[model samples]
Target: MPTIVVDVMPKAELLDPQGKAVAGALTRLGHEGFAAVRIGKRFELTVDAADEATLATVRQIAAEILSNSVIEDVVGIEVVE
Candidate 1:
């Protein structure tokens, strides 16, 4: 099986309320560790396709249906061999 990893993050221009709220709470929790922390969503994809072409198709599907290009970016794609 081939696994594809997907990540979605808020754009730099857009405001992230959830991230900001978490930052606020973290700061208040006495963990003033990092100056800033950006949070995003991650996923692991499982596919039975065994060819590169099919894998490409799956990637495209994930990009089109699983992600939004404007505000979020795909941060990683790791293929386990």
Candidate 2:
């Protein structure tokens, strides 16, 4: 079996309210030295097969249903086990 990692988040063009809120809280917490912060979502998946075809299908699933490409960006993906 192949394991997949999926991360999705708002694009640079859009506004990230959650991230902003966290950043504000950090400042109140006395954690300075930061200007901007962005938040994103992460998903871990286990695939039946570890092949290019299967991976492509997974990618499609991510693009169509898993994540909204228009307002999000995939920061990274890692296959574990």
Candidate 3:
């Protein structure tokens, strides 16, 4: 089986409270080199085959369920070993 990966992240203009909170915590914990953090979601789905058609279907699924177009962007989709 192969895994299809979907990465979802908030748009650059949108505010990410969770990411901001994490960044603040990182600074407090003495990892202060980072200026900002934007948390994102990755979804993995295993399929019987890794083909172009399967990839297309996974793209549709990610667009419909894995990400919110209003605020989040579907960065990319990949087939992982």
Candidate 1 to truth, TM: 0.79
In model 1, the Cα lDDT at residue 47 comes to 69
lDDT of residue 75 for candidate 1? 67
TM-scores for all candidates: the values are: 0.79, 0.86, 0.95
Global CA lDDT computed for model 3:
0.92
| 2 against 3, candidate with superior TM-score | 3
Off by over 4 Å in 1: none
What is the lDDT ranking, best to worst? Answer: 3, 2, 1
Q: Which ten residues in a row have the lowest lDDT in candidate 2?
A: 72-81
Question: Quick one: best lDDT, which candidate?
Answer: 3
Name the top TM-score candidate. 3
Clashes of 3: 0
Instruction: For model 2, state the Cα shift of residue 48 in Å.
Output: 1.7
lDDT of 2 by residue, 1-81 (tens): 778988888898898999999999999999989898999888888888767887787788778788888898776666778
Compared with the true structure, all predictions reach lDDT values of: 0.74, 0.84, 0.92
- Model 3 scores a TM of 0.95
Pairs of residues clashing in candidate 2: none
Question: Between the candidate structures 1 and 3, which one is better when assessed by lDDT?
Answer: 3
